[model samples]
Target chain A: MENVTKTLDAKGLGCPMPVVRTKKAIEELSAGEILEVVVTDRGSIADIPMWAKNTGHEYLELVEEGDVLKHYVRKGGKTTDKEETPVKTITNEEYLEIADKGPVTLIDVREPDEFAAGHAPGAKNIPLGQIDKRMDEIPEEGDVYIMCRSGGRAGMACDTLETFGRKNLIRVAPGMGDWNGPIE
Target chain B: MKVAIIASNGGLFDAYKVFNIATAAAATDGEVEIFFTFEGLNLIHKEGLKQLPMPEGKEHFAEGFANANVPSIEELVGMSQEMGVKFIACQMTMDVMGLKKEDFADGTEVGGAVTFLGYAKDADITLTF
Candidate 1:
């Protein structure tokens, strides 16, 4: 008989919940052992793999049973880890700080007229409508931060950068107008 | 580098949502853009961005810009350009708002839904603000 793998059901959760639970399960497991995670939240579908990559775990399988998503992951064998890395969640202040530093690209994803009125200091203008045809303008190096009037447009930019293999990407927590900071 | 943002709501909160998305995209090195339509045109109106009440529970901007560090409407529009975020005002909303090209910020442009649709059609991802 095949050995039973530890299963974690994290259905009906949102965003980081499923990923957090899976991380906990992987921590309790031994090397070569499998962890099966069942989740119903759609956000979990994207969060799991990202979590695994960030945590140095190997993702094995993903299966959908009925309405539930089942993911199988393997934990690393090393018990003594040298360094602990911080998770990559963008905050409003952090966004400003990064922008203040050089070698950063900041894009406004709003309409043209809106940009002319007010925006951040040193922010480049590229309405979301033109991003596809103007992909050449994007740089392959350095951190890229996406912003709009709200958080919605930034999410799209984050997903786009991730799809294009631009790993150093983050969405502003709030947005340019909503950010309680200085604007150009 | 393809970025697409959907602006469905018309309130100040909605405008802020789109602003955040564009700024974050720019930080990631992607040529970022935001498509404002329907109620989104309100975002361009100088008055619309200023003196608006903030969303509840948000201590910074919600308490009011005077008390908070939030940039004013004019300031946000200026910073958006500095950050490389392109702002596109919807033509339909412009007509509804009874506004003209001169009514918006310095570098504002007018666009219709077809323009935004064409741009977002093949985007890596499209998010509604």
Candidate 2:
């Protein structure tokens, strides 16, 4: 939470001006670093988020205390850089297309409950925590498509699988959050 | 607890009043729903909250809100949504006002008065604003 690298006191500023100033400050912000902007403008809560969305910044949140509003925005430019996994990856659409042609190995690294709730059809469930003991269940000779709720755990699973010298690992980027199709 | 709110006015304050109560009720782990009908449909228009301005003559209230840090109408609605408050857009009003289902916020249910009543029928508390 203390990741904020800079603070802009934008109090007493009126409409558009505060947001404009925020834009200026955001330009100077380093990628992935959070900027804590203190503003008195009530509209900033909505305006800041809108501006952030339009400008491609990550609107973390807004906190109101008494008569002051604090908006946290992170320079979204390189935020994905940190989350970029080293493993080979495919989108849900790509995975589906490949699966449609043949029996593809799709492993869901989400917890059992989440996998049970809804997941890609034919995807095997192996919780990220249990990947070690469940290594034998994972196919070693085929193109293994691993996924999770988002893409975080699947990346970790890729690292674990890599350690075992099982090189055919492809994580589903932005996983189930964007999964499109029928789920059993 | 189940909470139901009827928003009949379209003013900026109307949005604040409806969402304020809806969010407060929902904060307590209640199932809350706000029915937007008649003029209230203006509050749910895709860009309604942003388009709606402080009433004329109360324009100075903008400064006061700025000074007081009142959450914007959009913010309140967002908070209400995040707190699980359901928003229902009156389909009849939509047809009357030329508002298509896509004209309202995403996830806003397009329904008629009877549909809203169905949800409010068993509500523990129901209010009209």
Candidate 3:
């Protein structure tokens, strides 16, 4: 088998850094080529395999070379277009625009502790736990958007709404952590 | 488990990030809901989450969030809705922003603070993004 090999020196990079570098390196290679990724984060040890699967690259070998972790990935003959393509997310200006013209309902899915700390100026506190029973409370006229620390719980809230047949919903991308714009 | 997202940031970055998270959560058979507030309200604006700028030295905030396995506000909304996630927005913020019910993302809700808090109160895990 013909194989072209490249080395990625991502030893000190963080969680997504190594993955990004690895993806970039692979993008430059042809089928049957191998990319060797050296990373320092132990998280990569597990992330690499998932990346390979998610990206359609074949994960050949993963080894712990002392404190550094190494991964060997090969471009497969078949392309995996099922992989996700990165997209631009919501922004501060757009957020204002949407809110400016919405017959929508907004909920702050963060815990009571976090909500008390500080949140968007006029957001409601619908902690994730009580959403089910309180589903009736959410207005029936407009859409709903759920937000939490980062994007984790918001995603959860989005999912719940779908199950109850409450169509027209969204999550605050990047959640509260990324909201640098004006609050209340 | 049920899930919800708050897309408070106002650009494509948050829109897409929220979507990815919803997809992942829905894949696990979890119900999802997303509420937009503050700047997050912008995600519902017409084509609001499109072509957002990438921060200098940052490959676009949304891309970074995606590369990190995080969801964009819009994407979360779409994916969650596809897999059955509910979406919402803040009515107070809308009023303050001089917005109307018709201006938000097609399916977003305009709600209050207590509404979200009500949900967060009993969730297995609650987070603020």
RMSD of each: 19.4, 13.4, 24.5
How large an RMSD does model 2 have? 13.4
Stronger candidate by TM-score (1 vs 2): 2
Error of 2 at B51 (Å): 2.3
Q: Candidate 1 residues A50-143, lDDT tens each? A: 6666566777777887888988777655321112212134767888777676656877777778788888877788876776656667777776
Scored against the true structure, residue B128 in model 2 reaches a CA lDDT of: 94
Q: What is the TM-score (0 to 1) of candidate 1?
A: 0.38
Task: Give me candidate 3's TM-score against the actual structure.
Answer: 0.38
The interface RMSD values of the models, given in order, are 11.5, 11.7, 8.4
- Write one digit per residue (lDDT tens) for candidate 3, span B19-127: 5555545544456677778887766675555555554566645455555553344444454455566667788888888888787656666678888877766665444
Please provide, for model 3 over A1-184, each residue's C-alpha lDDT reduced to its tens digit, 9 standing for 90 to 100: 2233568898765544566567667765544457788888788787778777766778888788699888888876533121221222354446557887754466888789889888875689988788887888777556666677555456556667667777666666656766776675
Please tell me what DockQ candidate 1 reaches: 0.02
Distance (Å) between predicted and true CA of A70, model 2?
18
Best by lDDT: 2
True contacts kept of each: 0.00, 0.00, 0.00
Which ten-residue region of model 2 chain A has the weakest summed lDDT?
A77-86
DockQ of each: 0.02, 0.02, 0.02
